[model samples]
Target: MNRPSLTWKLYIGAFYLFLFAPLLVVAVFAFNASPFPSPPWRGFTLEWFTGSGSIAGKPGVLVDPIWLESIGNSFRVAIPVALLAVLLGTVNAWVLERAEFRGKTFVAMMMLWPLVIPGVVLGISILAFFSRVANGLEDWLQTDLDFLRPGLPLVVLGQLSFILTIATLIIAARLRKFDRSLEEAAFDLGASRARVLRTVTLPFLKPALIGAGLVALLMSFENFNTTLMLVGSVAPLPITMYGQMREGASPAINAVSLLLMLGVGGIASVFALTSKAER
Candidate 1:
């Protein structure tokens, strides 16, 4: 193996430092034993991680109720969104790969357009469309529908619009390598189409499906820009963190952010390791 030159090593180190310096600083300040969480580093302490503080004369300290509520809401939204996206996306991928039809390419392109469109634009469009639809339904049916109210269902719908695209793409990439002859052989041996799919095709696609579902779940959980616009009165964890930072960044917020980052990083690492092991 060729040894990396001094200049190359320095460049690589600098790149990694640039990438992680802010995260390191945030982690450090999260444990700083100071009144203010910012500059002029003092001794290290873990009190902030468990204690509370008053913000703008509000009698709340340590773990903020609003922040915790938002985090719970985020999980509520993400879990359903991930499940729905995986089910819909996996079916879409299977149909696109297994069936031949006119306009198939056009349909695929339309499905993928969400991945290229800006998140803010997509959020606005979905909000507008839903608003119009809800209004029309109210007028025609003469009844109020609570589904359009700003809450879990709306959040899931907004996220699924884009996250399903990601799941579809990931599963589709793996499907491209699949052997159609396996299905053909199953059919030749008297297996029905549904039986072939359930036994043969789905088994082969399991790993990719799991990986894609996890990716979609993470993306939905961490989403900010789109979720912020569509969240209405309910805030997700990212939105809560943003609000906290805007008001006055506390060490607790930093601790929460670090914990979330570590959780996500750990899950991704495990997924990667398992994938490699399977290969």
Candidate 2:
């Protein structure tokens, strides 16, 4: 391969720095001794990361009651939602990529609709759909299911609406390049369809499945708009942090922000590296 010009290499380096400088600033401020998150560095301090103000001897955001509660709630919503979204997405990808059926194009298009739709619109639509469906079901079945009301469940569904679509596309991209003859060969060799899938197809799809799952999980954890609309009483980390910011949050928020940036950045980096390796 021909070496890139010095200008091109410099531009790539500059682009990366441009992208990551702000993140570096936030991570640095997380340890800033100052009360504010911005510049005017005030000596280093671990208090934000690990020190209980007044609560049980525990320390840091991990110990704060509100932060802990919100984090727990976020995990509660994110984990199951990720699992369910991945399951549905993997199945959808398989069906769309491998199956030949009437209206498959239409079905695939509908599956991808959420990707193009605005998150706010998707949230509002989900809320409306939940209400309408619940009302109709209550009328027909004569049972009022209060769980259908906006809350964590609704937030999960709202996030799932688009997250699943993303996961489907990610997995489908890998699936489209897959060789179908492998599955056929396995089947011809007396392997059951389930066995072929388990031993051949699933293993080949593992990286994409994992990448899509991590993406979905991260998206669910940090979701704001869709979760905001569907959340009734339960507050996830993002929503809680948003409220705190509105009230003029303290430096603790910087600590949280730094952690989130590191986490999301790490996930993205790993996915990118693995993708490059696969290619």
Candidate 3:
């Protein structure tokens, strides 16, 4: 076996630093006492992290309704996007893996097509298509369908257009590993197809399904390029952060980042502890 060269180790270290340096900066600045997000640290402070009244000297972010509302809106968009993506993806994965049909390969390719499309282009396409459809409906109904305009649902649709492909691929990969013999045995035992699927197939796919939903949730929350175009009157966390930056806002953004990082870290720690206990 060959060992990696010293140059290769150095390259790997540099790559990791490049990936994590910004995150480290963000985390560090979240505790900076200065209102500014960057440099010449004033002092360590938790004002941003805890929100309003966290520090008596200034208005705290915790009590800021705008940020709180944006976070709430982010969840509203993310949850639905994840659910819709997972639902569509699971169904697509099931059909692709288990059912034989004409143009199956083509159908699979089409499902995956959005993954390759640039998010901005995809957003534009969805907006145009949805608007046209909504307009046509309005023409027939002779009334308004204002909900069809850019907002949470539109953002969800834009994100789902591609996020579903990721979930589909993940679930499909998991499904491919399933033991068909178990499904067959259930059928041989006079189990109806639906019954066998519910008892055996779904249980086998549960871990994958859960994983896909988690991935979709994260992606939907983080999605920006596609979401930016589709979000008109409302904003998600990422977009909210962008707006704050445009206004020359302070380290509250970093504080939000730190809070999110902590949340993710907490979850990971729990999983780690659970795994170690099981082991």
Listing every candidate in turn, what is its Cα RMSD in Å to the true structure after a full C-alpha superposition? 2.9, 3.3, 3.0
| Clashes in predicted model 1 | 5
Which tens-of-lDDT digit does each residue in 1-279 have in candidate 3? 399999999999999999999999999988888868778988887777574654544455566777788889988987997788778888999888989999999998898798789999999999999899999999999999877888888898889889999999988988898989999999999999889988998987776676777778778877889999899888888898898889885788788877778766764565456435432
Residue-pair clashes per candidate: 5, 1, 6
Query: Model 2, stretches more than 4 Å misplaced?
Result: 1-18, 54-59, 138-144
Give the local distance difference test score of model 3.
0.83
Q: On a 0 to 1 TM-score scale, where does candidate 3 land against the true structure?
A: 0.90
**Clashing residue pairs in candidate 1 (N, C-alpha, C atoms within 3 angstroms):** 51-62, 52-61, 52-62, 53-61, 53-62
Poorest stretch of ten by lDDT in candidate 3: 270-279
Which residue window of length 10 is worst by lDDT in model 2?
Answer: 54-63
Candidate 2 local lDDT, 55-142, one digit each (tens): 3133578667888899889999999888998799889998898789999999988997888888889899989988999999999999
- Residue-level lDDT of model 1, residues 207-244, one tens digit each, is 88888888988999998867877877778889888988
How far residue 269's Cα lies from its native spot in candidate 1, in Å, is 1.5
In model 3, the Cα lDDT at residue 255 comes to 80
Question: Which structure among the candidates has the greatest lDDT?
Answer: 2
